[model samples]
Target: MNDTLHVVEKLTEWRARALEFEREIQKAVLGQARVIRLVTICIFARGHVLIEGDVGVGKTTLLRSASRALGGDFARVEGTVDM
Candidate 1:
């Protein structure tokens, strides 16, 4: 009985923490909740993401923001015409 109660308590605490985390992400990422959600899903699933966009389209900003939020390393490199 004590163990079950402890598990339920921990779950409740995690739920509250998750809600707070979602709110923080929303605050940091304005007007791109969908993109944030997709990124979150990818991270949750342990998958890599390839963001395709033209220059100055917020791709780097989005990836960097996501990396900061997820507490990981972020790196960027410019591409050239040579293959």
Candidate 2:
């Protein structure tokens, strides 16, 4: 049906855009293809992500790069959980 075909076409276009977005983020955050792919999937799925790692691991850079690719602003908020 024409409607089904249209849906498929839209999905293909979205997929391409998502891939391109991922590539853009990857360009800024190097040596983390797996992390980039997972973040991209979560981003396109409209989900929130909390990245945790040791200090100086480029987490902020990854997030900033993703925000840039999304044409959005990045704000860093440091959090702590006091036991």
Candidate 3:
């Protein structure tokens, strides 16, 4: 019971932080709600994601914004093939 209570408290705190992170990312990137939400999920899930699309679709912008929100670095690489 004590352990469960501790977990609940931590989850609540994490949820608040996650919401704030989303808000900051949104402010930095405009007109990409779905992309932002997907990035947010992948970020908290601690997994890697491959964002692909045509040029000028905001993929790089979204990832860069997310990296800034997470206080992380962003890098871009161009490849001959898509993975």
What TM-score against the true fold does each predicted structure earn? 0.62, 0.89, 0.84
Name the 10 consecutive residues with the lowest summed lDDT in model 1.
Answer: 17-26
Write the number of the candidate with greater TM-score, choosing between 1 and 3: 3
**What is the Å distance of residue 33 in model 2 from its true position?**
1.3
Best by TM-score: 2
- Backbone clashes per model, in order? 0, 0, 0
Highest lDDT model number: 2
lDDT sort, best first: 2, 3, 1
Return model 2's CA RMSD, one decimal: 1.7
What lDDT does model 3 reach? 0.87
Between candidates 1 and 2, which one is better according to TM-score?
2
- lDDT tens per residue, model 3, 1-83: 99999999999998898889889988878888888888888889998899989988888888888889899999988875665
Worst 10 residues of 2 by lDDT: 74-83
Q: What C-alpha lDDT values do all the predictions have?
A: 0.72, 0.92, 0.87
